[model samples]
Target: HLVLILCMFLYINSVLLFTLRSKSVFCETSRYILLYNLLFADTVYLISSSLLYLLAAFRIKLTFYMCSVVILPPVLVYSVSPLTLTVMSLERFVAICYPLRHAVIITIRSTGVAITLVWLSSSLNIIIRVLMLLCSNTEFSFDLQMKDFCSEEALFRVPMYYYFVTAYSGIVFLSAGVTIICSYIGVTLVARSASTNKASARKASQTLLLHLFQLGLILISTFHSNIITAAATIMERSHVLRLHSLSFIFLNILPRCLSTFIYGFRDQTIRPFLIQHLCCQLK
Candidate 1:
């Protein structure tokens, strides 16, 4: 929860800084927009999941108001963000592959439309999941024996809910992976063709490295999801519950922490920006 709060605070601060200094400092409007959206999504996701985990950790009884106000929206937004990212990857692919027509093809209007569709699709899943949870008579309670900060038994008890969650999550995961693979391949081929120019090769290598890092983060998150699904499946069987629970904590929670580190510390541009921001804050 502390980490989540810190992440949320940093993200909000970054947005404010960006908004104030964007015109003077940030040259790439599109890149700034993408980073802003991603940070927003990460903030939402962390907050929502953190709330649930905190509640479970201290055995706090969740009020109806808390569930609706603090929990639902972030979870829904987080789920939707991956789909948005997949769309963004596709957009990037088109921009690089068809630089001649990129401006005409991916205007602000078109990107807005794509974002809307991704949100709508994600919203529908959230609606379905929530409705299913509400209509069902299952009680929501944490399993005492399990070490998971959040309750898997409470969730998987609703098989229908898990089914939809697994399917939609898998779809986003697979789609993102496939699109990244294709995009990487195309970009690499183009880079090879332009290798005659040293500057072009250098730029291409930098871009490729950035994408590789992004793809690595996505893959880590994807693996976390698979671990979760597997854990949820075996949650009822007492024998393997401990092992699954341990895996979940290390796999899911660790990845979220690692994501910011990898993106902020590893990226050439983000690293310097973050360092400068920290220095300013310290001073």
Candidate 2:
């Protein structure tokens, strides 16, 4: 059932991505381009995390280096969602608050640069985490087989990695949260202005709110593992495992799935094309 759900969402995400590139308009629009990047990262994250889940379910233990290679991409890519959301929120804010300058401020070139920076910053953070993980174990070796299930929790057991993850998540989410909230407030204020186009302002305001909701989902997904660990203290092992699986579906998989429908259905320009592509109507 879990595998089925993952595959379903993966197919949907792939279709949405193709729909985005099917037209020049989607490619040129800054928001659609950002959405493409967000969906792509989420797709990659889903694949990696699902692989780890399946492996753990099958009781397959990987060596330290192997697990690191498989899991590290997820760590790097998961942060991309919130950062991209922050960028998207700012883009909306500029569009609403500075209509005249928005085109100049948010060009195709700048959007590409922003996406590049998000990936670079995430990569740098992952590199630091990897280094800390290595240094935490003086006896660490590439060939050491993991006795425990291979998950982020297992790999992040060292105090240094744990502390670094905690701190990194705090800083990233706090900054992203602040940016989104400010953008929401700015858009709301603009929406009230008689000078602004009521329809467009209202739409942008709603989009910003959805972005905030998406950010909340991502934050919850990131912390779900920790929540599961804490619950294990008082719960039976079977109950803990069940809760873990449920959490993975609701927290991790569902949020990534929502991005497609949220943006796909909401935008008129993309809706028809998205539906056509989704229905496999190549004509």
Candidate 3:
């Protein structure tokens, strides 16, 4: 709990400092707007997870309403984050591939709309997920206690919806994964093929690599735990607990923490200010 709290504090302050220092530059650009939203989403996820961990550690019982309101929504909304990454990657692809027409193609308003749509679809998907679980329970005449199963694994165990939810979610994951991979792959190819600007091509490859690294981390962190938690016999309690702890730190915390820095430093617009802030703090 203390660790999570410290992380949240650092993450929030870092974002606040960055945002406040670059308000004009950040608020003016569509790419920055999407990045800001992504960061905010991560911030919310961190806070909610921290509170949930704190409560669990204290053995506090969260009511169905409380879990639904506090826990599930944030987790569900967090699913939108990878989708947001895909959008950002697409933005980069357009910029790299269609450099001459990038500005005209991806305007500020269109980017906002894209981000908004991602959130909307994510919410609907989550809603369907919850409803499916509830409907399945009702159909099977099983007790539907939303509060009982706070974990994703428990949610999947809910009878009738199990297969459908798994299938649907798998499809959603695959779609987003494909989109991100494809976009970055295209950017990498375009960058490599350009003979004139070797430096730009190298930079593009670097960016794609970062995107792929983050994507792989997110997928493993998000889905790998589910498999681990499901296979009860594979890991002993202590081992599972240790793995969970490590996952919480590396998968949940480190990736998000690194992403904010990557987004801030990767964009040339913000690099100068970020460097200035870092040097000032070092002094």
Candidate 4:
């Protein structure tokens, strides 16, 4: 509960520090819009986890519907973060690689549409999964054991559930991975070709690298169950459960926090704001 509360505080702090003001970074660009959306999704994910954690902590009976409500929105919204990152990378690629055509290729209206579609697709994905679960009783089962606030592993049991999660995660990994890698490569090549804009190119590459790194971390967190299971025997059961729960909290919240710091807080606007704030404090 404390951790979740702290996560919320950190996220809100980061957003207020960088994302809220008009002079703030990413505020004007499609990149800002996408970053905000990603942050919002992460916020939702954190809230859901925190809600479940508190409920379980209080011995609240997490019914099938409650579990689904807590589980589904986060699962669905969290996907938007990676998808947004990929799009941000591609947007940067276009800005760097094809500067002249970027205005025409990426516009506010178009990016807005793309974001809407991303949300719609994710919603549809979750809706279909629920419908499928509802239809095929044998393939899907809501396995919630809330003594210790269950993980995604406890959400689905047997048959198509296994296949669905595997395929779903695999597709997200492959697509987002490919999109980031290809976009970064494009940015790198263009940077190499443009001697005058070498600094900007290098900076863009570094930003993409951070995004990739965060994506990798998020993916690892998604497999928190496997990690805990693998190490369960080496540690006490209570220790493992505590660590697993911590991972679930951090994994959902930390990546976005880092992303905000790396991409959002490092903006031109925020630096001056930080400087002024520090000066005021010192005074």
Candidate 5:
């Protein structure tokens, strides 16, 4: 929890420094808003899910009350994050390809509506899962002999809950994968055509890099899902532990560490702004 808190603090400070120091050269309000939303989503994950893990690592038992309090935010944030990325990709595509109608189409009101929809959709996943858990008569009993975090056998003992979890996982993965693929193809096509102009090409390249970074993150998440499924299927302790650790490092820790490098430092505008911000802070 402390590590995650420190990382989050560093992230916020870096972003603040960059935003404050940067000259108002580009008035890309939509992009700025998207970045802000991404940061907020990550913050939610850091506070909720990451904290839970940290507490567990320190042999701290989170009270049922605390678990209840911490659970929803991370689940909702993670659920909505991919959707937000998809929306941002679409917004970028429209801005790049249809510059004339970009202003009319991607208005502040429309952006707000889109963000709300993403949040709503993401929240529904957790809500439905929680509802299923609540309605089920089956109680979760931890088996000390099992050597697993939670037993799938115990969960599947309730057939309805099993089906609900399966459906939820499928929907989330499929939705994220489809959006990512569509965005990649759309962005690639637009980028190819706009390659003639150096400035346009540069912007296109940056956008592609951003998309790639996001896609990598999603792919890591998908792999984590597969690892979990495999663990559940085989019930092997070693495999479960290994996969769980890898998933945590890649999905949680690495993404937070790499986000600034991929999103901010790689961009021409953001890099200078970050440097200026750091220098100013030092002075």
Candidate 6:
């Protein structure tokens, strides 16, 4: 059942990704380009994460190196969603608030540069985490089979490493939340302007709100481990197992699938094209 759900969402994301690149308009626009980056990152994360989940479910204990290979990429890509979202919010803000300069500020070349920076920054953080994990683990070895279940928590055994992750997650989400909120406020103020296009402004405002909701889902997915741990303390073992499975679905799978609906259904331009492609694929 779980595999079925993951595959279904993966198929939807794959279709939406293809739809975005199917036309020149989607390729040329700054917002769609950013959406492509976001969807691509989310898709990668979903694949890696689902793989890890299946590994754990089957009780397949991986070696230290194998665990890192399976888990670290998801961690790296995890940061990309929020960061890409921040960029997307800023793009919308510019489009509505500064309509005249939106073109000059957010070009195709600049969007490419922005995406490059996002990946570079995320890679740097993961590299640092791995280096620090190595330095801290005196007995760490490539051949070491994991004693616990394979997850991020299994790799981050040291106190400082966990602390560093907590701090980094806080900083990333804090900055992202603030940027999205500020962008929403800016759009709202612009909507009140006498000369602003009321319909466009309203749509942009709703989009920004959806971004916030999506960010919130991403935020929940990140802290799901903590939530499960806390709940296990009070619940029976059987209940905890059930709760864990539920968390994996709602927190992990559902959040990643939402980007498709939020943009695919909401954007009129993409809606018809996405529907046509989906129907053709169904047939």
Query: Which pairs clash in the backbone of model 4?
Result: none
TM-score of each: 0.68, 0.95, 0.81, 0.83, 0.73, 0.96
Candidate 3, residues 12-62: lDDT per residue as tens digits? 547545753466867877778777777777777766766665665566655
Q: Please tell me which model should have the higher lDDT, number 2 or number 6.
A: 6
Candidate 4 at residue 175, lDDT?
90
- Superposed by TM-score, candidate 2 places the C-alpha of residue 225 at a distance from the truth, in angstroms, of 2.1
Q: Indicate the residue-level lDDT of 269 in model 3.
A: 71
**Global Cα lDDT for candidate 5:** 0.62
Worst 10 residues of 2 by lDDT: 154-163
Worst ten in a row by lDDT for model 4: 139-148
Report, for all candidates in order, the number of backbone clashes: 0, 0, 0, 0, 0, 0
Better of 4 and 6 by TM-score: 6
lDDT of 4 by residue, 1-283 (tens): 7765666556454444443454534466676677677777766766776676667666676656557777787778877878888888888888888888988989888899989988997887787677667776654445543444544555544368778777877788779889999989988888877353888788888888988988887787677667777879799989987886787657755775665577545766555564554345364
Q: What does candidate 1's lDDT look like per residue over 1-283, in tens digits?
A: 4555556555644543454244443334454455455556655665566566567547765434344555566556755555655665666666666777877887767767776787788788778777776677455532223233334334434668767766877777777667766776776666566534444434544554554455455456545546656766756656445554454345444433433453456556666666666566564
lDDT of candidate 4 at residue 101, scale 0 to 100: 92
RMSD of each: 5.8, 1.5, 3.7, 3.7, 5.1, 1.4
List the global CA lDDT of all models: 0.57, 0.89, 0.67, 0.72, 0.62, 0.90
Which is better, 1 or 5, measured by TM-score? 5
Looking at model 6, report the run of 10 residues with the lowest lDDT sum: 274-283
Candidate 5, superposed: residue stretches over 4 Å from native: 1-28, 138-159, 194-198, 209-213, 222-246, 256-258, 278-280
**So what's the TM-score on candidate 2?**
0.95
